[model samples]
Target: MSGYFIYASLHQGRPALEIVDADSRQVCLQWEYGHSASQQTLPERDNPAVDELSESEIQRLFRRLLLLSCRQSLHGQDEPEQNS
Candidate 1:
């Protein structure tokens, strides 16, 4: 794990955060968030991408996702939460 890039996109029609191998452009990990549940997947590897990331890096990624989610809510893209 030399370096990785984090970005936001839609995975399976839901918002997701993705970590990709900078050199190979391979998606090393994905975290898809939905209304009901969130899914995290680590692609097959001896050392997972998440393990390579520092604690600060992981925090920053989560912060970025939070900001994106807030922006979506402001723009009315996010659906209203349903009371269970």
Candidate 2:
């Protein structure tokens, strides 16, 4: 996966961060959100034609993205208890 291309793809108004290997297969490290999107900075989503940033920058971005997803999932877990 060293030469794999990591890209942000959109489908049905959602955002998906994909890593495709040299064989054009989704090898590993895929990220996505249902009903949400990939943002450049904030309040935006799905930059399909964006250029690739630095590796360090991408690492930082993905770390933040994972953290946010965890927080959102925790929030959703609380909803069932509240409704009950």
lDDT of 2 by residue, 1-84 (tens): 124466888866556677655444645456554322444442323554333323344565578557645654765632444454
Model 1 error, position 8 (Å):
8.7
Q: Please list the residue runs of candidate 1 whose C-alpha ends up more than 4 Å from where it truly belongs after superposition.
A: 1-53, 80-84
Work out the TM-score per prediction.
Answer: 0.34, 0.32
lDDT of 1 by residue, 1-84 (tens): 345588888866656677775667887566654322332444344655535443444565577667656654675645665699
10 residues in a row with least lDDT, candidate 2: 35-44
User: Which candidate number would show the highest TM-score if scored against the true structure?
Assistant: 1
In order, the Cα lDDT scores of the candidates are: 0.58, 0.52
TM-score of 1: 0.34
Off by over 4 Å in 2: 23-26, 35-61, 64-84
Question: Which structure among the candidates has the greatest lDDT?
Answer: 1
Clash pairs, model 1 backbone:
none
